[model samples]
Target: ELFQVGQEVEVVVLDFNENEERISLGYKQLTPDPWLSVPQKYQPGTKVTGKVVSLTDFGAFIELEKGVEGLIHISDLTWSKKMVHPKKVLSVGQEVTVQVLEVNVENHRISLGLKQATPHPLELFAQKYNVGSRLKGRVTNLTDFGAFVLVDKDIEGLIHISDISWEKIKHPSEKLKVGQEVEVVLLNIDLEKQKVSLGLKQLEGDIWEDFFHRQKVGDVLKVKIARLVDFGIFVEIMPGIEGVVFNSELDENKIENPAEVFKVGEERLAKIIKMNPANRKISLSFRQAQADLQKKEFQKYLETQSDRLTLGDLLREQFKNLSSKDNSKKEGHHD
Candidate 1:
């Protein structure tokens, strides 16, 4: 369209054959080749604005200038994996600032990066936070196993199901919802993988640890039977706290089988015979708890009748009664 029969234009002569009377001419050759100056103009790390011209599965073509186009690979579109497609982040005719990653004048190729124009959000997040740091973030997405929290711009951290809470839950929605702002502890940061781990339960603290700190062995606690097994019974001392009561720890002579004597949901007092805070385990004995309770009751009784019944008088009276009963039994046998 730029050339016409009557219009005069600058042209470059290629070759002439006098025998055939043929001449070759080129109009584009008159202008300078853009690739020759590409290296000097678009150095690596140089920022340039360009118009998105085309989109493909692999990358997007950006027109830096007339006759000069660069490729923004799909991987360089964004640092976050959440944005999986380049089309989601870029559109044709839209202007964007990109960083020049490489220039290959020999191959007429230029590598541009859309995300590299700015500092990586993950790196920034690490600089601002660390393991055990507490921060508030909004829940952006949820799955059966975990939830994604937006901790910073274009940066997300995962809250695994186990880290969601101390209590058992079927799903993340049971305790959290999308768009909910929650306080989470920064559990870990994997720079190589570009992953961040957040924990909601850490903010509330570990229930087992707290239980161990407050309770100890020999402590009597009322617990509800939760499950009966071949070896023993599992009891819940409190919500989210569970312990085991072995069959031998029960009144074995009177109760041959713990399951036959105890049913789930039945409440009974038990004494902690052993405790291991490292593994969060507790061993309970029901018979020992009963003995302790009876001893405490007898002590209270003695305190109430202290003036009337001394320890020695009470023992002698019991001995005299035992002697009379023995004599009566012997006389009857002789007769």
Candidate 2:
């Protein structure tokens, strides 16, 4: 109001600066500091609804009252989703229900959590899925190390590349692709970190057991050479079942070069020399198979000679040969 008109107003003296000849007026200081009662009103673990007034990289500032604001850190935004920024989950003027995690009276700050206001999804997932549980899921994403499977809505489980298949694979893309439907076994669930580990190969029956049931040591099988290395040759005895034949076991004779002796796609008879069920590996030997075949043939030849020869016929032939020699000696003496 202009003083020339002599306007009437109420004012309280805040400070009187005698040196500067100035008077600082105060109208808002008439009320007490609201922060003194803030800790009592908004205690820890208290759920309150507030409007988001501003957002920062670390958290969002929510206006709980006219002068009181609480910060919701990015880590408290969700239980499972990893957010890079607060804006990705919250916006200005958004009304959100948050749980007060701490009330620092000394610093006059209120820490809040957005996820603590509701039941944690990870706890619910643990209740629904237990270890060894079989569930169907879709491949939501693929990485160099593993694939993220959407086991439930908004819930993803990781299937590491090593657990994708029994056979060795370079990447998860070799066995799975995005959007592919696959059955998985729940390997583990971490409630503290809210992490789920899944396995795709565990859903399928163990193939090694089936292979071992149909094969044993000394059993000869026809295998095709799949790969050749300096130390050994890998032969596929059956689909997904490969056996390694070391260079020393590749041939009966000394082999200068395994590649020259064993070519890819070339079929050869090999005997199972060793098998490791724990490691799921098989060792084969072509030289042992050749030796077994030769021994069997020699045994068959001996049996044939035994069937033709008789003890009495052998003795009569020997006596006749002895008499002819004696008669020839007597004739020579008479001459």
Candidate 3:
């Protein structure tokens, strides 16, 4: 008779030397079922430490013992999860301790959870991800004016393009990158609404500080045209501070298409025509100052008149030519 004393015994080898192989087996097949009385061994909701064997999109396969493995669903992995993939959180061969939430012997499926076994992630997220927190994360999504940064699975913040950099940002891609590590400032966190506002520019010095508080009206700055519009050209005096150079102030008279004269990133020494500290705006004019200086220089040149007869003749002829040209141009336009 086969023994059932929870011990292994040696058995005789069958087959002869003429046979290709012989086998020696142990006697455990005649034993009674211990799992048939699982209450005597283990119960439901049992706390267990397991080793992660494999991973799936839904969750991970954890081996609790020699023959027992439990399924920890993605939903059961964390409390504040908004995951599309599970490999981001858990990996194979990692050790994880879980709680037995359910045990079914009919289909032989065991449900496990890591969330209930540990403290909620949201509570920890609130503590870890807070205002003024500098975070390095991935740019998962982008919009016309902003981008979304994934600091964690459940935690993301919107970095508006304006707040994306110290310089003027026309698009989010100019500053942010998809799957790139970016440092950001936590502007606000709305726990009730579950929204986070982050800024990249906040990490740098305020651009307006050097332009506004230090400078005043008529403070001439060597400016460059950052962009051109129908009304004016935006002249960048500094890296981030841009001032408008109106078309009316661009030349001695009228001009068509301000872009014709000024292109983007074109440098010119422009005079600060106006400055509004309250609005954080500055107006620049290059032609106006040039005209003023030219007029003063012309007056000084005229004062050195050595000959009276030549001066009278020069004045009369120049005055008559100016009058004739103005009338002729006007008549041509009428024609």
Question: In order, what lDDT does every prediction score?
Answer: 0.90, 0.88, 0.77
Each candidate: RMSD to true structure?
A: 8.8, 8.1, 16.0
lDDT tens digits, residues 81-118, model 2?
66758888889999999999999878879999998998
Runs in model 2 lying further than 4 Å from the true structure: 1-14, 19-21, 25-60, 63-66, 73-75, 80-111, 117-119, 296-335
- Please, what is the TM-score per model? 0.65, 0.67, 0.51
After superposition of all CA atoms, the RMSD between model 3 and the true structure is: 16.0
Task: Choose 1 or 2, whichever is better by lDDT.
Answer: 1
Each model's total of backbone clashes: 0, 0, 0
Q: Write candidate 1's Cα lDDT for 204-284 as tens digits.
A: 778898899999899999999988988888999986778998888886366776667899999999999999999889999
- lDDT tens readout by residue for model 3, 1-335: 53678876655444355475655543443454434544433356677788889889889888876556788898888766465355877888889888888877666567888777875544567787668888888888888879999877667889988888767778898777788788888888776677788888888867787667788776667887888887888888877778898888888778876767667878887788788877888888888667767877888777666467688999999999999999999999999
Best-to-worst order by lDDT is 1, 2, 3
Off by over 4 Å in 1: 1-60, 63-68, 73-75, 80-111, 228-231, 254-259, 294-335
What's the residue-level lDDT of 33 in candidate 2?
69
* Residues forming the 10-long window of minimal summed lDDT in candidate 1: 251-260
